[model samples]
Target: MEFRGRQTQKCPRCGGKALINQYKCPDCGLIFAKLDMATNKAASQRYKNREKSAIVFVKKVPIDLKRWKLILYTVLFGLFGAQYFYTKRWWWGLCYILGFTLLSVCVIFNAPLLNIWDGGLISFFGLIVGVYGVCWMFDIFKVCLGKFKIPVSLPKNELNAVILSKEED
Candidate 1:
């Protein structure tokens, strides 16, 4: 009956196939008329070539109360750590030293996939919950030890100013 091939021709005026090979409506004299893809595979293939997708990357994620507390403590400890290193305070560095010491000890002392739990996720939650519990107790101890000094002498408003001063130092 007829021949079919790749999209090889285009119209000059509208740049569409209507004026090139196919019949344009005699009454309208239109150059670009849409065709049903069900009968014309070549036309549908042209659209498929233009389709594309895009992706994006994000940095932060939502964390729970315990994780939030850990994040806060870690930030505070890290700031103290830097301060201690600068001011030559051995006591402030004790936690970082002890933490690394225990980590090295753990690496040196492995028991081939150690299993202390009774085959459940309890062991996973246990560490996080345990750390949170310890932090709670530590908070209580600090509250008992002294009038809950707000981490530093500078007020919330003065933190930026204090930071600027430290930057000058």
Candidate 2:
């Protein structure tokens, strides 16, 4: 009896009295379902446009490292943060490089000097090396398991679109 809370009970498009289950106008063959379909189609088209734009934007920004390549680099050179360098994390890469370099130099050059301190210097060196090895192995696992992601700054909508496009591929 009531359509969309309106008391008139007339088709809004043609002002016809024909109403089928409060959703159709038989005179004009217009249905509320068709309107919903049209709305959905329009929304789909808009999403497609956004996806296209996002793809174009992604093209402009170069992602130098591939997932497999990153994993390989991590396995081979993660102790020196080569993966971080490839991912454009300059600060982390620098820290890893410096840490590994300094630790290696200390272990190599201090071996003779540490002999005077008996096992104290050996234990310290072993601890540092163990920590570094553990970190390197963790990084390798993270990269190989696809848990590591390259950080990129993108607008929210564009980022969604880009992620969607990547998933499609």
Candidate achieving the largest TM-score: 2
The 10-residue segment with the lowest total lDDT in model 1: 53-62
**Residue 153 Cα positional deviation in candidate 1, in Å, after optimal superposition:** 12
Tens-place lDDT digits, model 1, residues 1-169: 1225533334322333432355442323332222210111221232244311111011111111122443444445442333223222345456545544544444454343245434344444445445644644554444344322121111122111212222221
In TM-score terms, candidate 1 sits at: 0.22
> Which sections of candidate 1 miss by over 4 Å?
1-83, 112-169
Candidate 1, position 116, lDDT: 47
* Per-candidate alpha-carbon RMSD to the true structure: 27.8, 17.7
TM per model?
0.22, 0.50
**Local distance difference test values of all predictions, in order:** 0.32, 0.56
Give the Cα RMSD of candidate 1: 27.8
Output the worst ten-in-a-row residue range by lDDT, candidate 2. 52-61
In model 2, residue pairs whose N, Cα or C atoms come closer than 3 Å (at least 3 residues apart or on different chains), thus clashing, are none
